[model samples]
Target: MNRYDNERLSAIAVLESLRAGVPTRASTKALPDLRPNLLEIFKEDLKIFAGGQNLPGKFVWGKYGQGKTHVLASIEHLALDMGFAVSRVSLSREVSCHNLFHFYSKVAVPLRTPNSTVFGLQRLINQKTEYELLNSPIQNEGRYVHPLPALIFEDYFRTEGEEQDTLYGYLMGNPPSDFKSLHKKARGEKPILKLERKFKPSEHATAF
Candidate 1:
């Protein structure tokens, strides 16, 4: 659906509205308003990711509260709606080895893929999660038996931070299984994009 000017937004729009948990009582199905510039950026993204197209390494950065998280959430919902694997997180807490390593194990959404690999997603901008869930085992004739590819997407970024290079490095290469294990055996890791240091100091500490 042409979000710029349409009778109604497409399933993507509906998914985004839902992810945001916003109420859109105006219609039986809620959707996001394209708002011109927003629609243009989305269209550009589509063009870049078209079938057989080669997309260069790119980072999406915007001022705080400028809908970056919303856009990623919408994309994730869109992926899920398309029968793709998806896992997600919100880096609103402290970042520990446990926080970095717990990229998988979300299981699955109630209505979709019981055996599909978890979707790795996070809401912390410019942070890094040490390990990625990679792929997960799927069911064969009787039970989940094979591994399926898991797609990773990011919500926000800190642009240039201490973990910035390390975070991007983790996304491009293979990650060890014990990558900063909570137990810290020094042997475990997974590869994927993530948020870092976002969950430090604590939110209530600044109220003084």
Candidate 2:
């Protein structure tokens, strides 16, 4: 289709979503912000975070039908388009923010990057070499609460096919009982557990 045709289709899609009482990333982009001040503040906060500064995060509060979710959806899309990795989850009976490890599993598995609709970091992981993987900041202790994810990340690089997928799944929060066998096949050296600190879910959720 022509450029104009594509734009028209996208506009139609945005309108359809809005008509259904849901605003998506396309809808956010097409419509003018109802609360520019709030959005601008968030954009600035994102900029600060991107500059290597940590933020405690911001809270957006509004009564029902006030578009709080819409604003957050917009920010999620904006951050992804800016080349940032974004994971979004809503709290429910099954997924509560109070449980750190469970919450991490929910968010980590749905990881999204700028260009792909598929979740997880498989493509990015495959692009790196062993040297790059080992030297990356994640391998350093004190950066995160635990070094287990970093070790699994390195293991992810050493295996391929189903074994690689298993390790990747572990990194995404689904640990398999037979993972040690896979690691042995890939590295043929010391056990992976021996190479890193023991992971305690209570104390190590932050690492992933």
Candidate 3:
């Protein structure tokens, strides 16, 4: 197929996947050029993130059919290209903003990275070194202690055996009730329960 035809087919496939309630593999290439203003804003925000600066969250607000999802997918693709991990979650009744635990779980479930488009968190946990993973938390305890992302990292690296399964269960909204029990089962006494228990139920319920 010609380039245009190929792009058309790719867009169709993405729409089909969305209709099927499956994750779409849409990339920035599939999207038309964003408006110049939007593009500039995206670049500026991306530069901040790439520079290791904390940028406040930007919300995309539009009615249905205004290309919100497409814009988000494009941003996600660009973030991955820029070596940043991305996760996209659509809020529904089941994963509502009113319910923090469910929302957090949904966000973790769809995390994507440059290499892995789905289940990227698992890949990250397995690939990142213990020192690499623990360095920031060790250096700056305030930033990484009780945040949702920190909880995820702590739970995944809490014990050695079946780490992936434990994280998967947490992302799936079925966190362990007791980290002490989990550590005992793994035959490791690392003392993560205190930190784990410090999190609010909305924060650590899935992985606690």
Candidate 4:
């Protein structure tokens, strides 16, 4: 009777066809139309950024069910052929115990570090904020410190099920460190975790 019900009916029709092994009408994807041109643009833009020409990132965004995910999958497929760093996240598992920490090894009975009790996480990777690096003994004890790289966040607007809102909050609220810079990326009035980087990159990068 209403739009929501109609949407449900349409989805059911799609499912019914799949279940019955009936073929639905097929159409060409935008990926075949635009991937090469987009990849070339990204490569040129990345070169400019790497060379310190003050460029922006290359991200793609599209409306829901518009095959954006499929396009991203195609990109990942290309990445594999080209040997690029790639990963896909399942927002459905944001709070799973397995994601928290899997490798377990108890640090003998005497966990001697004094500040260890203060921090919640057991495993500590040294992180270097600009201030810490300048002031601390890090120069004396040389070590690279960081979080995951080029964090890829997909499905920002997924409506998966009961856990959907929770997972969305996790994504919008506490983004991984690499994207801490984009932390200010928010929805309406809610303020999300953001990075200290200047607005230069976010300003120029075009998504969609």
Superior candidate under lDDT, 1 versus 2: 2
Residue 174 in candidate 1, Cα distance off native in Å: 22
Model 2 regions lying over 4 Å from their true place: 1-4, 190-193
Candidate of highest lDDT: 2
Sort by TM-score, top down from the best: 2, 3, 1, 4
Measured with C-alpha atoms, the lDDT of residue 18 in candidate 1 is 56
lDDT of candidate 3 at residue 207, scale 0 to 100: 36
What lDDT score belongs to each candidate, Candidate 1 first? 0.37, 0.82, 0.63, 0.36
List clashing residue pairs in candidate 3. 175-206
* TM-score between candidate 2 and the true structure: 0.86
RMSD of each: 17.0, 2.9, 5.4, 19.2
Kindly give the stretch of ten consecutive residues in candidate 1 with the minimal lDDT sum.
147-156
Provide the TM-score for each candidate, comma-separated: 0.29, 0.86, 0.64, 0.27
User: lDDT for model 2, on a 0 to 1 scale?
Assistant: 0.82
Q: Residue by residue across 126-155, what tens digits does model 3's lDDT show? A: 677546755655335454344544545555
lDDT of 4: 0.36
Give the per-residue lDDT digits (tens) of candidate 1, residues 91-180: 443522242223222222122332334323222222343232222121131232111111211211322342333333334232334334
What local lDDT score does residue 36 receive in model 4, on the 0 to 100 scale? 71
lDDT (Cα) of model 1 = 0.37
lDDT of 2 at 7: 79
